[model samples]
Target: MKSTLKDPEPLLETQWPADPVKPRKAGWGGLKRRLAPYGFVSPTVILMFVLMLVPIVMVIGYSFMNNVIMTKHPKFVGLDNYVTILTDSVFHTALANTLAFTFASVAAHIVLGLLFAMLLNSPLLGTRFKALFRAVYVLPWLFTVAIIAVLWRLLLDPNGVINFLLMNAGIIDSKIEWLSSPGTALFAVTFINIWAGYPFYMVSILAGLQGIPKDLYEAATVDGANNFQRFLHVTLPQLKPIIISMAMLDLIWTSQQFALIWMTTGGGPINVTEMLSTYTYKLAFSQYQFSLASAAAVVILLLSMILAFFYIRHQKARD
Candidate 1:
């Protein structure tokens, strides 16, 4: 019985102290670790809400009303402003002018930019010279839109340096009304815009060009591709992505251009050079028709997005 029996241990005899090191609670550090990304993005989010979203929401709301500068309160008109804008002949003309300006300016920018990029990428030039030329090319981009507009306005004036040069050079017998006539006004503004904007394309395209491997050019040369052939097949194909993106950006920018056109032509000569942006500004400020201006702005935004969408899709598909 003594051998088989087991003694009961005293429960309180071997009492142990509680853990000397307390369990670590999730403190500020742990919480911050979890929320770090959100904290980093909070400023951008707040700015977007305040600057972009609020303005866009206000514009959309105003588009549905009969809002004017004269009235303290907006009267809800339920799409009447949109209807009027859509039916207005001035809006139609502005739309057409905008389309033409965007297309022409973007086209010229792409062509001239790519050409300049190619020239700058040439191995014949020294690196320092290339840098100098690149700076020279990009100088136009540094000029403010208003400055460019004013400078070109003077150059394009009937009695300006351009006409003087043309007359002296025997290119024309008399001065041309570059910014006054309806026929030339749109093109004149477009030309100035193209000159100012092409540098963006040049810089972007040059970056793309520099990124292309020399091995690819060597491979093309081994295949007996001539200079023109290399440009068409190798250079263009390699630069497709950059070209597409630059073209899209140029389209959007040129379509939305207000300052240059406003300062240069002021949408003059029967609104011949009036783009949607100019029209919107005039509607809101000059005419005091806030609702119509908002509607016009919305239309411009929608049209720009739609056209950019299709143009990008087409380019990607072509590639």
Candidate 2:
């Protein structure tokens, strides 16, 4: 056994150095991932900047200058344009008319829309009847502004069907100049706007009604609440947010309405139906007072922004 044994070799000791840590260099792939969101949104941002922001800035600059867009060298006039617009009697009249039109239209729209929506939502009505009424009520919303304007103009003409019917019914002694008379032009336009806009309110309210919880109504019924009581307490409470939001939006839109009035009354009849929109247009294109128009536009923008602020706050509060 001893003669067959062989000697073992000793093990060698080795010390290996740690590999150097490499700093990560971001590749094109990593960079692309980081920038992909911005790249996707850049077009929209650029488009808004060019179309909206640029125009707004230009208008603001024009508001502070004299003879803007009409003269070779426009002079800075500070707040003179604003002062002139604010003090102008015509501007005051336009403002008053705009307020009257907007408030009346929004109020009537809500009242009529709520009434129609309630009728449509009634369980007593058959589905076929509901569908028919819904279609008829919403027909106005499907027409373009131009079409609506033209249709209303024809209908409100002095010798038109409306006058004929009114006269035959003994409601009027003579044909009324609905759009031509100063006293009636504002009323006529307001009525037309209300007719055209109420369908939007009706649709929105109908949706809101459908979404209301049945349990609330059931509970109200269990509490011995009458139909009117339930509607006042339950239905109105549920639709409050929707109604408020719609009213504000309608106010903004109705305040800016130009096409309908322009096509119907042309802000005529001694400017009785003149709105801020028409007033600004006249200052710019008709009177060649670009600075005054810009100032007026800025005022309108400010008013709209105020409305938007309230709207956004309400939405956030609702959320």
Which of the numbered candidates is closest to the native, going by highest TM-score?
2
Off by over 4 Å in 1: 1-29, 126-132, 307-319
lDDT of each candidate versus the true structure: 0.89, 0.95
Q: lDDT per residue, candidate 1, 1-319, as tens digits?
A: 4587678876777668886997899999999999999999999999999999999898988899887556787688998999999999999999899899999998999999998998899999999999999999999999998889889989999999999999999999988999999889988998999899999899899999999898988999999999989888888898988888778777777888888888988998899998889899999899888889999988887888897887879777878
**Which pairs in model 1 have colliding backbones?**
none
Q: In model 1, what is the error at residue 288, expressed in angstroms?
A: 0.5
- Which digits, one per residue and each the tens of the lDDT, describe model 2 over residues 1-319? 4687667777777878989999899999899999999999999999999999999999999999997889999999999999999999999999999999999999999999999999999999999999999999999999999999989888889889999999999999998999999889999999999999999999999999999999999999999999999999999999999999999899899999999999998898899999999999999999999999999999999999999999999999999
Top candidate (lDDT): 2
